[model samples]
Target: MTKTQARKLPGYIFLSLTALASVFPLYFMVVSATNTSRDVLNSRLLPGTALFENFSKLVAQQDVASAMWYSSLNAVGTTVLALIVCSIAGYGFEVFHSRGKDRLMAFLLLAMMIPFAATMIPLFQMFADFGLVNSSVAVILPAVATPFLVLLFRQSARSFPHEIVEAARLDGLGELSIFFRIFLPTMRSTLAAAAVITFMTAWNNFLWPKVILVNNSYQTMPMLISNLRAGYVTDYGVLMLAVLLASLPTMVLFLVLQRAFAEGITGAIK
Candidate 1:
């Protein structure tokens, strides 16, 4: 092989190994979901006929469906609100360009560095005061304007063409119209990536939901999964099934939108 081709071969092998490493756990989870608890304890890697039994156990659990629904609602709600707010904030921060806004952005970055544990009590108290505790809104409100998403949007907005904005302004398009009709469509990929990240974070969130949601009826999938594992005789097969079901939406979303998500990120960085 040519020297360049030889150099690329190692990178390709490394990538393949990394991909396998990532997929291995998911494969194991799928296999375990199809096995009995005994089979899971024995680390069985092959699919078995116990899938229906495990699924039946999962469905028979009173809160499983409700928890899944609540989790889905929280994930979808948080993603939509976060994308709208953060994207707008990001676009404004980059395009408006004021010293005060720059300082605000720096403060936001500092806020991001603060551990969530530090603010957990205060956040919970605020939600309690607003009578939002035990609601999906409680899980979503604190995440709607995430600093990380704001930063992502700001970076993506850097690639937004200034000439287009100027032309839109000259054509008498209002600021909101320009943003929605012009900028949004152009930055679809970046938004898709942000949406995926936000949805995953919301779906997998445990600590905040566990703390805020006092009612078992309103618990999320992660919280339910935790409760399941903590039971006296934990059923590994059932737990695996719960995990597989919990993971389905994000997996499907990534499969459907991954191309746009990847391109958006690449474009933003470029």
Candidate 2:
């Protein structure tokens, strides 16, 4: 090999190993979905012919379709609302050029350090008082204005061109019109990244939803998976199948938006 090729070999090897490590669990989960509980517990690495049987068990045990519907509703609601609210906050923070905004932004960042567990009880109580428990609103409302998403949009907005906002204002374009028409189009990648993040988080959220959505009819995919493991003698095959199904949407979304997600995360405008 050439000298340059030799020098890069170790780095390539390390990256390959890391990639394998990342993919192994997914590989195992897929394999386990096709096998019986015994084979899964035995750590069998090969795919089996029991896929249909496991799927049947999953269907028999849970309302897979209902769970998916509720999950989709919650995820879509959270993503849409979070994008709107956080993007506006971010745009105002970066574009308005105000004095107190920086201090307020810092305070929002401080709120991120506060663990969700610390506020979960109060949130539950508030929602209960509002008679929103066991509803989709209870699941989606809490996540609509997270500090992390605001920060992300704020950082991305730093690269936005303020000259455009000024020019639009000179033309008498309303603030909402500018945001919907100009800002959103210019920041498509960032929005995609934010949507993917928010959707995935809402889809996978377990604890809050578990605590709030008491009715079985409002079950989400994660809650379905949790229920699958709740029995004393868990059906590993069915559980794996449910997990695989639950994970598919987020996986597909990430795969589709991965490039934009990377760009957005790095605060790159393009």
Candidate 3:
């Protein structure tokens, strides 16, 4: 090998090992899903022949389809709403300048410091009072105004060229139109990254969904898989199947938006 190739060999080897390590758990889960409970419990290394049977059992015991649908719907809804709200709020905060606005922005950012658990009880009470409990509204409402997303957008918006805003203003474009026409298209990658993040959070959210969705009819994937545990003997094969199925949306989302996700992170860091 050439000298340069020899020098980079260790780095490549290390990266290959890291990539394999990262993928191993997912590989293991897929393998386990195909196995019976006994085989999975024994940590079988190869794919088994029980894939369809396990999936069938999973469907029989729980509303896997409904859970998938609810989870995907709620996640998508939450993402779209959050992006709209966050982008608007971020653009407004970045563009508008006043002492009062600065104070409000500070307060908005400070609100992010408080853990969600701290506010959960009050939020639950408020939502329950509004008759939104056991509904998608309950989940999406609290998540709609994510301060982190707002802050992320605001920071990213700082990099937006004021020249475009000025030109748009000269052409008599309204604020909303400028944002929709100019800012949205310019920040497509950032928006995609944010959507993926929001979707992942909403999809994988266990505690909030669990607390709100006590009724099996309203439960999502996390709750459904959790519910697999009845009094005493739980179905391992079925649980693995459900888990594999539950993971599909998030995995697909990440795969599709991974480039944007990387760009967004680098842009934010820059």
Candidate 4:
């Protein structure tokens, strides 16, 4: 090989090894899902013939369908609400040019530093008082107005063309009309990124849902996976199968929107 090529070969080799190491756990999990419990405990690295048996056991023991439904509902609901609310807040922060708005945004950003554990108790008490405990609304409401999403949209909105807003206003379009018709459509990439984030967060959320959703009927996929290991005799094969099922939606979503997500995070206008 040439000298330059030889020099770069070590870097390429290191990256390739890192990539393989990152993927190994996922490969192991998928293979374990097809093995028996004993095989999984023994750290079998190859696929086995018990895939159907593990799936059957998982289905028989858990309400997989109901968990999927509730998780989907919560995720979709949270994504839609967060997009609408945070997008509006972001648009206003960037375009309206009002005094103290920056300060307010900073305050909101600061709120992110406060861990969720600190507010969990008060949030629960408030929801319980409103008779919303064990409800999907309780699970979704607290996540809809997150600061990170608002900040993400605000940063994306910074690149939005103000000339379009002024032109639309001169043509007698209302502020709301200008936003929904012009701004929303223009920020599609950021919105897609935000939607993926919100959906995944809502779908995989464990601690908050576990605390608020007291009813077993309203369990989400993460909760279902948790329950699989709650018993005395843990079925590692079935547990891996449940984890695989829980991971599929987010994995598929990321694969589909990955391009948009990247563009959005980097503040691409298109």
Candidate 5:
């Protein structure tokens, strides 16, 4: 073979292996979901006829519909609030760099460095004082302003053209109007990326939710999965089905928003 052809062969092999590795778990999950518990434990590789039975058991054991609705509400609420608050904070810190604002920004960044575990007790106490324990608001409030998102938005905002802001100001637009109209529209891709990240984070968050949300009624998919796994006689088929259901939202979000997400990253990096 030619030298160039030989070099390309390794790349092709590596790509194929990586693709297989990524897809293998999904394939296994599907197989497990279709098998009975005994078959799943036996590591049966083929799809079986037990999928409907397992799904029925899953639905009966957990209030699957209610859990799904609650999870969706929590995830969506947290994502929307976090996106708006963090993006605005990021934009503000970048565009309005007064000494006070800069100092506040530094403090916010420092807050991010403190471990979430360290602050859990204090945060819990504060929530208790406000009588917000076990509430969806408890989950949404704490995460509305994520430090990483603030930093990301700040970086992306640096690419915004100052000339556009000046032009908007010359047109006698209010600051809020300028932000909502000019800045937001121009940063659509950046916001889209942030939305995907924030939504995924909220959807997958386990620890804080586990701590704050006590009742089964308020439980998220992660909590449900944890409880299911902790059962004495675990059904791997049912567990796999639950996992697949839990993962659907983030997968859907990525599929829908991937183009904008990629453009945002590329634009920010450029």
Candidate 6:
């Protein structure tokens, strides 16, 4: 190899090893999911024929369907609402300049630094006062908009063309119309990234949902998975199946939106 190739070889090997390390657990989970609980105790990598049986058992033991439904609802709802709210707020922050606007955005960033655990009681109380405890709304409402997401949108919106907004205004398009028509379409990649992020966050959220969703029927997938692990005699096969089921959507979501997400982030970086 040339000097440059020789120098880069270690880096490439390190990256390859890191990637394999990252992927192995997921591969093991899938392999385990397809095997019997007893068979999973072995370290073999091959998939077995017990996949459906494990899943069937998981469904029988827990309200997997209801958990999935609630989780999906929370994820989708959060993604949609966050995109709508964050995009608008981002656009406004970037496009509308006034006194203290920068300070307000900075304050919002500071708000993100406050740990979620610190505000959980107050947030729960707010929901409880509204009679929304044990409801999906409680799970969805708190994270419908977040400071980090708002910052993401605002930063991404900085790359948006300002001249178009001015032209739209000149053509008598209202601010909202211009935003919906011009900004939303232009920011598809950013929106996709945010959507994936929000959906994943909601789908995988354990803390707030665990605290708020009191009723068994409304418990989310993460809670269900936790239950599987909580028992003293844990079934590895069943747990793997639950994990796979819980993981599939986020994987699918990333696969679908990865291109847009990449473009959005790279665009912002530029």
Off by over 4 Å in 5: 99-103
Model 2 error, position 267 (Å):
2.0
Lowest summed lDDT window (length 10), candidate 5: 62-71
Score each candidate by Cα lDDT: 0.91, 0.92, 0.88, 0.93, 0.88, 0.89
Give candidate 1 regions above 4 Å deviation: 1-14
TM-score of 6: 0.95
Off by over 4 Å in 3: 98-103
Per-residue CA lDDT of model 1 for 151-183, tens digit only, reads: 888988888888898999999999899899998
For candidate 2, list the clashing residue pairs, or say none.
none
RMSD of each: 1.9, 1.4, 1.6, 1.4, 1.5, 1.4
Give the per-residue lDDT digits (tens) of candidate 4, residues 1-270: 999999999999999999999999999999999999999999999999999999999999999999999999999999999999999999998898676999999899999999999999999999999999999999999999988988888888888888989999999999999999999998899998999999999999999999999988899999999999899999999999999999999999999999999889877433
TM-score winner? 4
Per-prediction TM-score, please?
A: 0.93, 0.97, 0.94, 0.97, 0.95, 0.95
lDDT of 5 at 206: 91
Candidate 6 on 129-158: residue-level lDDT in tens? Answer: 999999888888888778877888888888
Write model 5 residue lDDT over 35-148, tens digit each, in one string.
988998898989999989999999888877877777888889988898888878888988886899778878888998898899898999999999999999998888898888
**Most lDDT-accurate candidate:** 4
Clashing residue pairs in all predictions, respectively, total 0, 0, 0, 0, 0, 0
Error of 5 at 58 (Å): 0.6
TM-score winner between candidates 1 and 2: 2
Model 4 CA RMSD to the hidden true structure, in angstroms: 1.4
